[model samples]
Target: MRFTFTCHATDGHARTGVLSTPRGDIRTPAFMPVGTAATVKAMSIDQVKSTGADILLGNTYHLMLRPGGERLARLGGLHHFMGWDKPILTDSGGFQVWSLAGLRKMTEAGVEFRSHIDGSRHMLTPERSIELQADLIGSDIIMQLDECTTFGSSHEEALVSLELSARWGERSKVAFGGTRATQALFGIVQGSVFPDLRKRSADALKSIGFDGYAIGGLAVGEGHQLMCQTLDVTVPELPMDRPRYLMGVGKPIDLVEAVHRGVDMFDCVLPTRAGRHGQAWTWDGPINIRNARFAEDPDPIDPTSTCPASSRPSKAYLHHLFKAEEILGQTLLSWHNLGFYQDLMAAMRAAIAKGQFQDLRARLRQRWGFAPLD
Candidate 1:
């Protein structure tokens, strides 16, 4: 609500800023944990908070289906419904409509598709998406409903999609109106991988205007280099005063790379999803808890990590939990990964503030055994 972004420091294209909202101040470059369906999977609200996350992302598509958005409203919004009082950002359900819907129809108005869950029919127009996020979910940061295109679409296909998305963005702004009341509406730029189309989309969004801007339509199988390259062209076109969010993005390396390219906000399911399968993300690298070499490893996941899962519990015990198929394995690993991600963001923020982001990034790449992406 009433989001304000103040750039505190800048190192190359990377900058550190704070996103002030009604719920709280989100430190950038922040990593928002994905809490689709009102929950962050294996972790409790307190556990999630302990990870140092200032905001979380909710899925508008899933909530609109099961449990229903109206139900959440009656229960006093997503914050009260999920018991997390921090800032919440909800996607406009465009990506899910493209990914999860079965039979679909796309038009100038919006998309009509059958739900992947229970075959229910739904219409997701730009106005409807805004209503769902603002009126029902009460999201602090709301995204506009825009068409998402595949990574390798032809230039013509991408141009049509981007134009339609721009129209939808206009509709979304009209639906949002000027009665934000502490809520922020963001416009998404969708142009697949075409630089000219991305510039056009960005210019259109700037013309329409929004509280923030998001880089969309990548990360759908485009490698990190292209994503970074796209940002190279698109990010400079956006307003410097507004926040920049990169939606549905990726691994630890991906986060650092995007931050280097001037992205301010991010959300992904990688950490929790990987943890559920017995993986742990450490400063050294991601390690598999199920590895036979760790069957008797007595060390914790990361002895220096502030998370209890990494500081108190040993790898041997975590390995035992995984081998035994115990639920604690998922819980512990998820906690560690979430805490690690927050720590990563915090470190980057600090580095940027000190004008040492490049130095910090180089150290991280060396420690994580990743060569620079040239």
Candidate 2:
């Protein structure tokens, strides 16, 4: 199927919909598990699929460095190479390259940086990024190469970054070329914390046109309130017909709030990363399985979850595994966390459909330790 988004229900700013792609339909507001190296850390492809996730987010920076994108295409693209038949979204390697800080140099052409893996030099321009994600990886959804403006930037600093990103967005669209039919290219809006610049960036992307629009440059030390305020100014500037994606945001509370602000898709590594460190996210809130109180607790992470990793293993067993430094602890918690995220998304969709999203949000915020909206 060609890429399309149809909004089926709405409650205030929150809406529920389906993103139709050739591989499958992704339900909104969707949370994609981060598969940084073609894997969701400790979880198997089957386990990731079992979590009700309709799509997975792949990292272009890491993939291009390790196995190389050309090799992946020669082996039949990422889907076949990774054993996942579902829709996949690949980010432009911009953020990863930007994070290199002292290791990278940014120019009008693109970013030049040394690989963290082997200290080898590489250049990633908008065209090259598109070629890797769209043609080489065969990703269903591809993001444009945009400079990720860091938080605490002055208006002058942000304007410079925003203009450069707009230029890159145009180049990325051009590089996409004939692949438009099978792949969806998304333009990312980057303006740091400035509302005016955010609006300008969104307008620029709309002029270039895209299958979707992504809100980037937030969740980088800017608090939750600031992120939502930025979204308030940015999301409305986007086309209502296409999908709105929030990049690198996966906190449970953040997901709920972003959906309320009208974002349809999100991806982050928090779930799996936290799992590896013994954090378990539940409906009530996040709990550390390593807490001494759980040493003898007989309850599973969630007795109601259909996922075996969530419902079958008791908290005591999980705690013991972590204490013993066993690998199974990471696998089980990772499985449970992804499952919990999917469950949260499903609940959001259901609540929106019933025009009770606000009620659900209120309950979640309170449970997750956030004060009520003033």
Candidate 3:
């Protein structure tokens, strides 16, 4: 899809924008819920849509294994397959092919690995990744097959990985290289956390060219501060016209900070994963439904919440569901978490449009507090 990024506001190094795509218009500083296997876990498509999410994400590794990409394609692409007709972004399967595979081999061409599910063999190159994204799944946004390095790696190790990733990005562009269609290919900049290497990666991606740029290899294991710093250096290096995406990012504070540093798009599994465990993300803070304090609190999770699940159900009842091990516990919490994310996105869009991002961010950080989050 053709991406148009508009810098609506700037607070220090932070800025906000909107990404116009084929499926829809994605307001920048946007959070995309991870629909790993055609679903966002406990929530239905309409439930997810109600969260104010204009876009969604799919995992190439997971879908290629479970329902199979070809099966989904035959069923009418990911949109029809998942019953979500919005903009969908799919990771290139590089991270999972390396992290989830039992044994993997890498060469100058691509990487080969056995599927984590059935032990079936698969090969993932830039070309294959693009083909998988385009012909098979029809993702609105397609990411390049780049190495996602760990935080603890040595500078030399990171350098090797980043160089390989840069080279692979070139190959991915060649594979995805064409006039901009509804599906836009993005290049991932991977350098672990080293600033110089990040510059190199960004420069390489710029040289090769893409419809967008993704700050990859972050959030793998690095804490938030370093992640923010890396983005501070990396985001400015990307082409301003194309969208700047921070792949697989985290919590409320992390999102706000990255937005401050000019990241436009993100996808993460935190909300739903936490939801399944009985945690609810609210405008105030994260509330654990399993806590004894909520057992008798006869109040909606968020009475004024835009999400139906949060505004409709009471915390006391949700707590009862948790204590009774009812499936509704997961459903409600998941709904609330997604709602919170959507609310965050809305606030960011408003702040940017009003040119009051710094003020809004300070207020959010103050409301969220300096208390350490895990």
Candidate 4:
């Protein structure tokens, strides 16, 4: 099937839509669970699907380092290798390389870094990143390789990085060639916290043209206010017809606000990561299952939840599992957290469709303990 998106409804800046891919349709204001290393940590593929997730986000840097992209292609690509039939979005591995800071060197050509696993040397260029994600992994949506700067960089530094990313975006497009029939490529907007640079990056990508656009370099400690401010200036510059994705973002409040600002897609490791640490997300913020207060609590995480992990098991049992260091605690919490995220997304979609997104956003802010929006 040809890749396409259709906006079904809109309430102010917030909207709901469907991203049609050959694999399946992804609902708008969607949350994609991060599957770095071909797995979503503690949750099984079936468990992830049960959470109502329409897509998964894969990390190209890790895959290329380990099982190897070539090996994946030989074995019928990541979908076949990982047993996931849904649409998958693979990152260009630019952020991973950027995170390697002291261990990596960036040049006009690409990034060269030592593997965190075994200190193995690797070079990741825009062309190589595209080939790995598009051809080898057979990803439904492929991201372009772009340089990511720190949160407090000077405007000059951000501009240089933005220009370099734009250049790489061109190279990535050339490398991607023509694969729109079965796949799509997304260009990332990177400009730290500068509004003008962000617009420049977005305009540059629009000139090159892409199936989608991703806002990168936020949620790296710029705080919620600055991130939203950046979005206010950046999102309006993007084409309304194409899907807007916010990469590596964030808490429930962040998602609520980003959706309100017109972002259609998001991916983060927060839910599963918090779960592994014994944190469970709920409508009323997050609770730590390891706390002594839940020792004798007979209630489940959420009695109304459809997920077994959130409705079947009692809080006492989960606390015991965590206290005993059983692996089941991680698995259960991960499942419940993902389920909560999906529920949040579904609620957002429903609210947008009903033209009541503002009401939903206000309620969520109060529930999640965020200050009321100005």
Sorted by lDDT, highest first, which candidate order results?
4, 2, 1, 3
Task: Single out the weakest 10-residue window by summed lDDT for candidate 4.
Answer: 365-374
The local distance difference test score of model 1 is 0.92
How much RMSD separates candidate 3 from the native structure?
2.2
> Candidate 3, clashing residue pairs?
1-182, 1-183, 1-184, 14-260
Output the lDDT of residue 196, model 1: 95
Better candidate number, 2 or 3, judged by lDDT = 2
Better of 2 and 4 by lDDT: 4
Clashes in model 2: which pairs? none
- The sequence of per-residue lDDT tens digits that candidate 1 reaches over residues 1-374 is 46788999999989998999989999999999999989998999999999899999998889998788889889899999989999999999999988863477888888888888788899999999999999999999999998898778899999999999999999999999997869999999989888999999999999999999999998899998899899899999899999999998988988998899899999999999999999999888899999999999989988887888789988999999999999999999999999999999999999999999999899888888888544
- Tens digits of per-residue lDDT, candidate 4, 25-67, equal 9999999999999999998999999999999999999999989
The number of clashing residue pairs in each candidate reads 3, 0, 4, 0
- Residue-level lDDT tens digits of model 3 in 26-127: 877789999988899999998898889989999887888778878878889899988988889999998887785347887788988887666788888888
Which candidate achieves the best lDDT against the true structure?
4
Question: Candidate 2, TM-score vs. the true structure?
Answer: 0.99
Structure candidate 4, residue pairs in collision: none
Which portions of model 2 show Cα errors greater than 4 Å? none
- Candidate 2 lDDT tens digits, 1-374: 57999999999989999999989899999999999898899989999999999999999999999899999999999999999999999999999999999999999999999999999999999999998998899899999999999899999999999999999999999898854776899999999989899999999989999999999999999998899899999988989999999999968999999999899999999999999999999999999999999999998989999989899999999999999999999999999999999999999999999999999999999888899866
